[model samples]
Target: AIFSVGVSQLNASLAHRIPAREENILPTFRKALDLAREDADRLCHWISQDVSEDDFINWVTGSVRRMWGKKGNREVQAQFESDEGRRSVFDMLINLAGYSMKTKDILKQCDRVVEGAVLMRSLLKKVSHN
Candidate 1:
């Protein structure tokens, strides 16, 4: 979810910079955008599933390079290599994993607490009957 927000921000940032009449460039830009979102979702999944931090970071670094690498349309590639693009990627790498993991842990703890409360309530009802 956090990654989705980041992607939205990225899309908005890119949309503002790229001119509308550059229809030729838009396809490449859209493809890159789709790839980025997919990568972010995969990374988020890895984080929530308890992938090692070192492994996660390694994948992110490599993925960013591949995504923004020199092989694509020069204009598209240059856009991704720009400061705004780098910043967005950086934010995702630094914050996304940590935030996802923290959220997963918090949810787990909440579930356990709720389960305990339910058990306690059941026990209390039995005791009250006695």
Candidate 2:
């Protein structure tokens, strides 16, 4: 009983030292989406003729590239660091695309990412306790 109590106390001390994970991805994602929408609108305005499929593709590519930049990547990394954040990421990925092979693949990958993050967090907690 004394040993277990000491172990628990140690674990508690270590856990307190570890900082809580942040949830910044959702807000960044929302901001990125809004910026993408605005950029797409601007691109549409610049066209003299009827917008074509190519134009739409360009807009999408540009917007995604902008959003997936350094800061956006950091935000995503922050989200993937936490269990709840992973769920938020998974939901965001699901809502971004419709029922398609790409969406399915991303969803599968997201599940793995979430599971991996949870496992890693647990391992960290255990290691800290030890």
**Per-candidate TM-score against the hidden true structure:** 0.24, 0.21
Question: CA lDDT, every prediction?
Answer: 0.44, 0.40
- Give the clashing residue pairs of candidate 2, or none: none
Give the per-residue lDDT digits (tens) of candidate 1, residues 54-128.
433343344333443433224222333443322232333333233224435788656545543443343333333
Best by TM-score: 1
Error of 2 at 40 (Å): 0.2
What are the RMSDs of all candidates, in order?
A: 23.1, 21.6
Q: Write the per-residue lDDT of candidate 2 for residues 25-72, one digit (tens) a residue.
A: 444445556656666675444332232334323422443234444543
Candidate 2 stretches with Cα past 4 Å from truth are 1-22, 49-130
Clashing pairs in 1: none
lDDT of 2 at 69: 49
